[model samples]
Target: MTDLLETVIENREMVQPNHANMLETAHGGHVMKWMDEVGAMSAMRFSGETCVTARVDQMNFERPIAVGDTAFITAYVYEAGTSSVKVRLIAEREDLRTREREQTTESYFVYVAIDEDSSPTTVPELTVSTEEGEQLRRAALENEAE
Candidate 1:
């Protein structure tokens, strides 16, 4: 078993012109790619096996992360099945100098663990060991409902 919090991964990407759209904000595809990479990392952490994305839930972009801003991403495994892991991902636009951030995108992704033979493999059970972990799981569930 693995504690849900143990599967959490957080990282930051500095938005550059190359990752931006015509409006100078982050391109949707680039943001989704970052989210997918982070979500897969969380899935791999929980499963201890290579994970491949199977599905991506609806993604909603609430705001824009402009060039020179930071795209702060947090991904965590909240649920698991025999061979699948469900991860919640959130992206925020951060002004590094001001230490301010606002939600820009949120989504859920499902990944399947793969064995050396390149077949689906069983994953460890996911657990919430502490109050913080429980709260984080609950928040992800609640957000997913919206």
Candidate 2:
């Protein structure tokens, strides 16, 4: 089994005007897309197979990111079932000039591995090896409560 902490993956995207809403803030849909992509990548890394999103739990937009900010998205597998992987995702915004960062969104997403036939496939067990991994797992569980 792969250590989930070591299997974590990250992705980033810049918030441009096209990715913003009329309010000039990052669009909710865009954030969701970014989260899903990062979460999927983590799941794939953990499973070593193609994966598809099965569900997204409690995605909360905590803050607004303005255009020109960079969105840093991180995803890690925290738990696993027979064919499912639960990923924790966080999106943070980095100011272009000041380089300040603030977490703008958080979510828990579930994905299922698929075989070449596109059927559900089993995945290796997830192992949390470090304090940071344990902390993220705890935070994900806590966020699920809210």
Candidate 3:
């Protein structure tokens, strides 16, 4: 089993004009790209194999992030199956001027591990070691709701 805390990963990107929409806010597609990239990284790190997104359980965009703000994306592997890893992802926007941050979006993504030949690959079990890990696991369970 692998400790899910050990699989937590974070990535950051500055929102550029090209990443903005007609409203001058960061485009939802661009944000989803960032989330998918970070989530894949977390899944690969947890599974030690290539990963492909199986499902985006939920994606909620709470606020808009304007161009020039830094998008901070954090992801962690919270659950695992024979070949699937459940990841929790959070995206926050940091105000460069005030140094304040606001969560802009959140989602739960499921990824399936794949072998070199692109076949489904088994993944190690997930271990929850700390209070935060337990909390995330519980949250993932609640988020599943089925």
Candidate 4:
């Protein structure tokens, strides 16, 4: 079994000119790509195998990250099935100088563990060993219920 806390992952990226769209803000596609990478990390960390993104659920874009801002992302495994791990992902738009951040997106991603042949393989059971882990799982469930 893998504890949820052990699967937590976080990353940050500076929204540069190249990452911006015509609107002069980070493109939605770029943000999703970053989320995918982080989500896969969390899943693979939990499964201890190569993980591939199988589905993206309920991606919410609440705000945008400007070209000069920073993108803050966090992801963790919150649930697991026979061969899949489900991750909760959050993205925030941060003003580096002010040290302020506003949530920009939230989503759930499902990843399937794969063997050397790239075939789906069984994943370890997910365990909530800490209060933070339990709360993260609960929050994800509640968000899904909404």
Top candidate (lDDT): 1
**Which runs in model 2 stand beyond 4 Å of their true positions?**
none
lDDT of 1 at 132: 94
Candidate 2 per-residue C-alpha lDDT over 114-146 given as tens digits, one digit per residue, 9 for 90 to 100: 999999999998888889888888887787778
Candidate 3, residue 36: the lDDT equals 97
Clash pairs, model 3 backbone: none
Q: Give the TM-score of candidate 2.
A: 0.95
In candidate 1, the residue pairs with backbone N, CA or C atoms under 3 Å apart (3 or more residues apart, or in different chains) clash, namely none
Stretches of candidate 3 above 4 Å error? Answer: 144-146
Using alpha carbons, what is the TM-score of model 3? 0.94
Q: For model 4, what is the error of residue 142's alpha carbon versus the real structure, in angstroms, after optimal superposition?
A: 0.9
In each prediction, how many residue pairs overlap at the backbone (N, C-alpha, C within less than 3 A)?
Answer: 0, 0, 0, 0
**Alpha-carbon RMSD of each model:** 0.7, 1.1, 1.5, 0.8
True lDDT of residue 124, candidate 1: 92
What is the per-residue lDDT of model 1 for residues 72-111, given as tens digits with 9 covering 90 to 100? Answer: 9999999899999999999999999999999999999999
Point out where model 1 deviates above 4 Å. Answer: none
Q: Is candidate 2 or candidate 4 better by lDDT?
A: 4
Model 3 worst lDDT run, 10 consecutive residues? 137-146
